[model samples]
Target: MNYTLHQLQVFLKVTETKSITKAAEQLYLTQPAVSIQLRNFQDQFDIPLTEVVGRQLYVTEFGMEIARAAQNILNEVQAINYKTMAYKGKLSGKLSITSVSTGKYVIPFLLADFLKQHTEVELVLDVTNKNRVVRSLENNEVDFALVSLFPDLSVQSIPLMENQLVLVANRDFPMPKKPLTLEAIQALPLIYREAGSGSRFVMERFLNQLDSKGTKKMELTGNEAVKQAIMAGLGCSIMPVIGIKNELQNGDVQIIPAEGLPQSSQWNMIWMKSKNLSPVAEAYKNYLLENKSTIIQNHFGWTEQL
Candidate 1:
């Protein structure tokens, strides 16, 4: 009934990633080592923990229960370690952050200065869709999440920057010289993000407000893919201005002058209020609140008007 913390960590990683090989890579351990540890962990219990079917690992019900307990234990251990480091007035620990895909445009810039100042801190950034980011936060897997849409009232949200969504088309696409109406814009072939994306949610809400019944012409998974689709003349899309800065500067895409366009949203850094944050995470949060606007303006040349 005894299992080392390292074995539990390996088990948790395997369950989280659903791949022994991936867990090995992430833990920087050999695949055989991970497999051996997983086997040892399972040997401590009578019931089967996981099953492999068609090359995919699936955690059983008992395995899920154990995984949850393992995560709690791991979290508490980390909390204790961070608390100890705090008493020493030292800032040296890992900070795991998850953010929406569009956040890729901003979080790195926000982190650059912080990283330079705290050379001992390790930062792990995961860029995904809004839904996945929220799930990560809810699971306490990440210390903070950056998103445009606040999922619920339970988390502490710090508004960091303004995110503006704008209609963009390939520079070669025929665009009206004057601003188009909402209905006109709706008629154009539109490339859109997947349903779970915050950008898609905003765009859909905007269209719904206009009472527009038209459906998007194409659906892409990522911002980069949507940008590529637009540049390929596949379809136009409504995207966050942050993600299109490079393309706009290069004249690969142009913002369409549409009535009621440039929908404004807020970029919020969110964290579970009930959870205790490591010193590094707390410092990064404060840093974002204090310096995000200036850093963003300097890095992206965005004005308050945006």
Candidate 2:
């Protein structure tokens, strides 16, 4: 209770590494300094933090609980630091972002443009599947995430762009005369993104509502893999209209009309409501708002900026 955030941080580092010396090395602190801080923190708690068994430092159950609390405090303190830096008009702070893999095709370019505009900001990006992005956001592991149709999380999402999900097949495939129903689409072999992905989640929900037997005939992890499979005529796949502009233009793939499908999904910019935005985050958000159409046009080579 009487411990400073610095001391709690040292305690967490020591607890995680299980060695005062190793924690000091990782934190760029002297071993004796780390040891003293841990001792002081333990004194405040009036409990033994670590026990030496076979030359390995082990955190007691009580100590581990304290460590968990310490971690939350440390995270809040870091968030405060980020906000203070922003308030000072000094846009130099770490901005961590996690996004779905399909975003890999677009987000990197958007981030690059933001960095070009604000060279002072440090950006770290975790490009992953949709579920991991949502998990990272919920756990406070990242500052913000760009994802598609996720559940209503404890955070807020600002939708940047609304995009249609199009059913794509190789140009050689037979074209249906009318807008296809879920049953008709389900009759074709389907290539799908993994289950937890935002695209897959939206597609599944839409299909489940329309046809009880809807299922993916094949699964692929990345957008590139799905594109390759669809191009090879292995199966039909659904993706954002934005994602396959090049393929569609080149006549490599064709869109299959599907009725009763959701009209569009948003490319959302999301952050925890309780967490304050850093200056760098604000800058990036502003950049996205202003240049979203340009980025979309550049990515898709659209004649008219949308």
Candidate 3:
């Protein structure tokens, strides 16, 4: 009745994919290795865990039940490792964050140092649209959220860095011979991010504030797609400078030097007011609060000049 954790892992993987070959590929082991582990794991149990018929692999009902138990064992093992690291006076736990799509450019830089310092901590950064990010935060599904659009939600935030959405177009697009004005920029066809995106929300706010009547071209989800659309001469868009730095530098796009832009907002690290923070989460928040300015100055000093 002796089966190793490796055996259990192989067993679970086989059950998941219903193929020893697939389990081997996913586990980065040879097929023979996986086969051996599976055989060793199954030797202790009399009931069959899997079956193969007509050249197809299948997990039996009992195999599915054992897979659940194996998953629980893996989970407990992970928890024990975190607890042991904490026992050694190291901050060890999960630091989960849900960030708006554009926040992808910023969140990783913010986390890089903290993760390096606390090697025992596990990080999960989920990048999605503003609605999902806010939903994850409000549902207490994550320790923190990175977002720009602060709707009417009961949350507290720590402002991290300046986020500016600027009007940009393909380098080959037509530009006014005169000064770049709101009217001039708005006269061009425009591309937009999807409705519930933080970028779109801010873009709408700026346009509404200026009473713009620009022709709307099309809407795309995610910053990269919008950037690509603009580069392909599809249309112009107001995009976060952070997400377009590479494109701007490569001459793929050009920023319109319109007054009152780049429309500015602070990238905020937000959390529900009543949620209790774990040690890892608290340490990360404090690290940002204390070192965010330094990190920005070091990695993003160029952003200040922009």
My TM-score estimates for the predictions, one after another, are 0.85, 0.69, 0.74
TM-score of 2: 0.69
Q: Which window of 10 residues has the lowest lDDT sum in candidate 3?
A: 205-214
The candidate scoring highest on lDDT is 1
Clashes of each: 0, 0, 0
Candidate topping TM-score:
1
Candidate 2 contains a number of clashing pairs equal to 0
TM-score of 1: 0.85
Model 2 agreement with the true structure over 216-280: per-residue lDDT tens digits: 67998888888889999899877776777788889999888778643567778789888777666
Residue-level lDDT of model 3, residues 1-306, one tens digit each, is 787888889998898788888999989999999999888888888999888899998888988898989989986887788788888999898899998888888888999989999998888889987878877876778999887868577888998888888888899976667657777667778898999887787788777656656679998988999999999999999999988888878999988777678888888898988989887888998999999889888877877776
Q: Give lDDT tens digits, candidate 1, residues 84-199.
A: 77688778789899999999988888789889987778889999888789889888889989889888748998787788999899999777889988788778898889988989
lDDT, candidate 1, residue 175?
A: 77
